[model samples]
Target: MKKSLIALAVIAVSGTAFAQSSVTIYGKADIGVARSIGSDVNELKQAAGSRVGFRGTEDLGGGLKANFTYEHRFLPDTGAVANTSSFFTGRSIVGLEGGFGRIDMGRDYSAAFWTALAGDVFGYDGVAANGGVAGAGYQTVRFDNVISYKSPTMGGLTLEASSALKEAGAKNGSAIRVSYASGPIAASIATEKGLAGQKYNGFGASYNLGVASVRALISKGESATGVESDGMLLGLVVPMGALQLKASYATLEVAGKDTVQQMGLGARYALSKRTDVYTSYANNSKSTAAKKNGIEFGVQHNF
Candidate 1:
């Protein structure tokens, strides 16, 4: 009887410890077939960047918590690594969180990336995405060896900042962003200085009504030699039950270079909570070249 009692006591203690910690395994996969106006061949493609990841959190006393995430991208069609050289190619983060806010150190995203994503309907990885304009002119993406901080929201306003340390004679990069979201309105502004003497600034905003949401962003950048360029993107989203409609337009104008424009439309139908079917079409036009159009049909599932 005593041995059984001791076994039950051990099980109870172990269960309580696990109740204070949680871990989750999550991933998304998307694949599609696409055709372009100029090409007669159909190609297999990853509609959006496919990724798998693990995340966990542990609660500590005094309102503090420890968190971690490890993620990587892959090509679903071929089952090949998308990041190639890096293992945790999507995001590898370790951080601490509390009332004062959260601080993380790892290979992570830039402040300008968050700003651009604030108004992008299709995000950066999609075929019909509008982030190309901003991404082309700025390093509004991931950074290696970064330390970042995000403050707690106050009156719907939040602040974020990040820094990448210098290495091998390279210049240090830094970025900052301020954002506000309340009710039907959202807005953000960000600026960054990347290595190789590149500088960028961006602003974005969006408004939501009962049936639709509209968003827009503009970015300006300068190269190492002082050549300047500007980019703009506009997007709209409409939701009807389990179906959604998305559209966007983007433009980029560079000094001493031809202007580029793109327009895209897409639709998504949710089959369940974790699976969806989507299709998109995009037209690309260049001032000095012929126009091209592409279409994509794909399915996505999350687990």
Candidate 2:
């Protein structure tokens, strides 16, 4: 009886300890140079992987806990971490989480954008799904003032919603995402629509089957920028030992005429848990447009 009592006490104490004091710093830094061939001109580009997360939690009581997270991105090649105008991108945010799931207010990602990105291969890389010329996605990586809600996983299913406040009469975007993971497979679907002033709507999904993962995405937008756009994306990634293989095809149609199609292939070698070397070759073309065709290759590392 005494041993049993002691064991119970130990378990209780251990559980409490597990609930408190956990501070960890994690980030991913990837560097790669690229070549773009279009208009009889070639350009070289380098970039950094997006990651930098710190989180912790403290038990409150009665199955309740408090938690927080902070994240950011940086360029490893040139050691530059700023906005496009050489000012400050100010790329960092902090938020909290708990039983009702989590509510983050500050400079946070849009539900739609995160959903599209979460379901893509190459972590958005040069894959069409990434949309950002390489991995920027169709819409920009939203930040500013925002509120996001993430519901608890309900039987392998998760839901996320977000809104960025641009105030009354101001153009804003709203997004939602649903995801599920089971066994050796994971999947996510999402949609985003613009409100206030601009207009954007999109759908995306992805699946992983142990050795290979596949992704797809589509988006449309109309805005005061005299804009009309549509896009379709497909991607694949296969793993072989410490090496990974990636391939993808993407197509974009604007208004009812201009079009862009892209195809890319790449390889990644794991150097360690936090480091890898990568190289990719990609080409882009316009079916009925004049955007020209382009190709690229490079390597990357994370730390």
Candidate 3:
């Protein structure tokens, strides 16, 4: 009886500690059908990057808090893991937040990604990604074994920096981003350095005039082997009731080659606060090849 009483007391204490923390489960499911010029059959696509995650925060007192997040990506079509070898390929992070700012360590997006995605009309979605169509590609989406820091916003300015530790012979990566958002204007400048001296720099800005918004981004990339590429993107978004219309044009120029151009148009309709349907079309034109066009339609749900 004495031992049992002690066990119950311990359980109660543990329960109380758990109650001090808040945890939430969230996920997104998105799938679509896409048709391209060279495909014999239309392919199903993961339009919004399906993911499930848990995030929690614990008030540790003294104006400081502990936070953690774990997320995994999966394919809704086949119910298969996006990265079979790594369970939490999407993100796994833990850190602290206080008056100074926030710092996290684990797998997280590079600073450059935040900047690029901010200016992207189509985001980094597969097939229609602005990175592939215009920017320096999605080469710096996420980094493992990383430490990132964010400064508190002051005077409409915020700063972020991150570094990835070298693991498995992969080169160390580092990135920085500076952003400002005030009233109807927002802008960001970001840079990244990857293994083998690959470097990327980008600047983006957007302005909203109530009725519509315009966004643009320019990026330069240099390969370790001395080749260079420059990219530019321009996009517009218009909102009408529950519907949004978007159009974008992008160009990529490589040394001694004709510029590659891509154009995209899309529309999204909101069925509710948590569900939406979208349709989009993209055309990629290269100087040395026939133009390839793709069309997509899909629905997404968040919970």
Candidate 4:
């Protein structure tokens, strides 16, 4: 759908609205309880990482714009913020966006995050592998003070890159991603390197088949955790009227020795344009140990 802008009519006499750009406030809050089942262990915990925040945008005119955002997380039920945690504060930053694309400098998501996000059916409901090859059993999230650039789409392809400053005397790792989408087909390639001697590379592709879409990803990674691993994921998301159904399977292999596999299925009901309620379940090799699998039923509102 083409975006539409609505201008409010105001007096020109000492007009404060246009003379200076305006600030907007918006945020999201959600809470839920969760339980996971391992082979021999089972645990329950109050929902965590619920959040809220403020964001603003200003028009400099002439197709130029400036903006800032500050997002934070809190325990809605207990009303507590993540302890002394403001690093990225749940995605805080300042940046600009225009016709040529966008650039932002601050803690950010790497281009490799695509695989991670592919499994975020409920804003990430704690699935093993989190859809990346971060040496298996782990999902690499965001980086700090990242300068990210996104290029305008060209010939059905778009590209993104991010770089973060590693402390001192360190080679800050970087991530690059490229994708092409035309009609019912899309594909992407991504890779990342961590300053702590960790490295990851992967590729993903998707195709629309009638009311459903199919996707797959594969990656290999190394980390100082004495772990070297490889992994892959296969997923399908189908849309049915007001609801969307998702199912996925993933595997993690350790040094060509042991392999752990997982599968998940879920459904999302769109309550409105920017609001949704979802639930999902995951099972892994450890199921025999804690076998609760995992389930989350929650709502998310975005503006």
Candidate 5:
């Protein structure tokens, strides 16, 4: 009888501990058919990078928590890894959060990219994505061996910063972003320095006026050799029940080079809460290069 009582007590303690922690598995599958300007045949593609992820949190006492995330990206069409260099290309991080806010370590998205993403109506997905303009000439979207922090939101404003260590001959990098989001208005400014003194600064803003939401972004980049490039984008999104319309124009200008311009139009219809279908068209033109355009149709499901 004493052994049985002890076993029950242990089981109750284990159950209580288990109740304090939670884990979730989530993923998205997106695929599409696309035809580019120079391609006569359609090709299978991932309109949005497909990914599967696991996240968990443990509730400690005093409102503090421990958290971790692991995400992997893959090509749904061919079942291949999207990033050959890393298994968890989407994100892999462990962090803590509490009244002091959150701090994370490991690979994660850059502050500049996260801030600029708000101004892109397409969320940088699809052929109509404006990420080329938002990122400009900077290529550091996610950094490895990094440490980052995000402050608690105060009156619709928050601050985020990150620093990446130099490894294997790679240069050190750092980024910071300040953002404000409340009601129908959102705005942010961010800057990042990477690789041999190359630097980029970006500003993004959005406003929703019931019938439509308007977004704008501007980015400037300076190369290690001091050459400069600039990019800008303007976008609009309109919603009609389950269907949404999107449009955007973007331009890039580099020193001693002709300006490149792009225009995009797209629409998405929600079939259900977790699934959607979309179509988009994009055209790019430059004074010195031949014009190119593409169109895509795709569907995405979330789980």
Candidate 6:
């Protein structure tokens, strides 16, 4: 009888401990058929980078918690890894959060990238993707060996900063962003420096006016050799029940070089809460080169 009582007691304690922690498996799968710029062949592609990820959190009392995330990106069409060098190319991070906000270490997105994403009406995917303009003059999307912090939101405003170590003789880089989001207005400004003498500054803003959302972005990049480029984007999104319409125009100009411009149009329809179908068209033109156009039709699912 005593042994039985002890076993029950132990089980109860274990259950309580387990209740303090939680883990979630989440991912997105997106695939489509498209013809890309400068290519005459239509092929399978990812409208959005497909990825699977695991995230967990543990409560440690006093409103503090420990958190971790691991995300792997892949090509849904061919079942191949998205990045050849790193398995967890999406995100691999461990962090803590509490009243003091959150701090994370490992591979993570840069502050400037987040700002750019805010102004992309297409959410960074599809043939109408604004990646070329949004990410112009910026470092790679994710940084390795990075440490980052995000402050608690105060009156619709928050601050974020990050620093990446100089591993393998790589240049040390740092970035900071300040953002505000309340009601129908969202805005952000970010800057990054010290990546192989590259420097970038970006600003993005969006306003929702019931019928539509308008977004704008501007960025400037300077290289070590003194070459500079400026980029600008304007976009809009309109929602009509389950269907959404999007359009955007962007331009990039380099000193002493030709200017490049892009125009895009897209539409997405929600099939359900977790699935959607989309189509996009994009045109690219350069002052010194022939114009190119591409189109895609795709489906995306979240799980």
Clash counts per candidate, in order, are 0, 5, 0, 10, 0, 0
TM-score preference between candidates 3 and 6, better one: 6
- lDDT tens per residue, model 4, 195-257: 675777677777889889887777777775757788777778899999998888777787775
What are the per-residue Cα lDDT tens digits for candidate 6 across 1-303? Answer: 999999999999999889999999999999999987666789999989899999999999999999999999999989999998999999999999999999999999987778878877887887778775776655457788999999999999999998999999898888999999999999999998746778788899999999999999998877778788888999999999999999999888777564658889999999999999999998888634343888999999999
Q: On residues 209-299, what C-alpha lDDT tens digit does candidate 1 reach at each position? A: 8799999999888887888888888999999999999999988878957466888899999999999999988877763434377788999
RMSD in Å for model 5 = 1.9
- For model 6, the superposed segments whose C-alpha errors exceed 4 Å read 1-9, 256-258, 287-291
lDDT of each: 0.85, 0.63, 0.84, 0.68, 0.88, 0.87
TM-scores for every candidate against the unseen true structure: 0.93, 0.77, 0.90, 0.81, 0.94, 0.94
Instruction: Give one digit per residue, the lDDT tens place, for model 3 in 1-303.
Output: 999999999999899888878999999999999875334468887778899999999989888999999999999999999999878988899999999899999999888888778767888674455665344642377888999999999999999999999999888999999999999999999999865677778899999999999999988887777778888889999999999998888888777464657788899999999999998887777634353777889999999
Model 3 ranges with Cα > 4 A deviation = 1-20, 37-40, 287-291
Candidate 6: the clashing residue pairs are none
Model 2: lowest-lDDT 10 consecutive positions: 127-136
Candidate 3 backbone collisions, by pair: none
Give candidate 5 regions above 4 Å deviation. 1-12, 287-291
Better of 2 and 4 by lDDT: 4
- lDDT tens digits, residues 96-116, model 5? 999999999999988888866
Window of ten residues with lowest summed lDDT in model 5 = 285-294
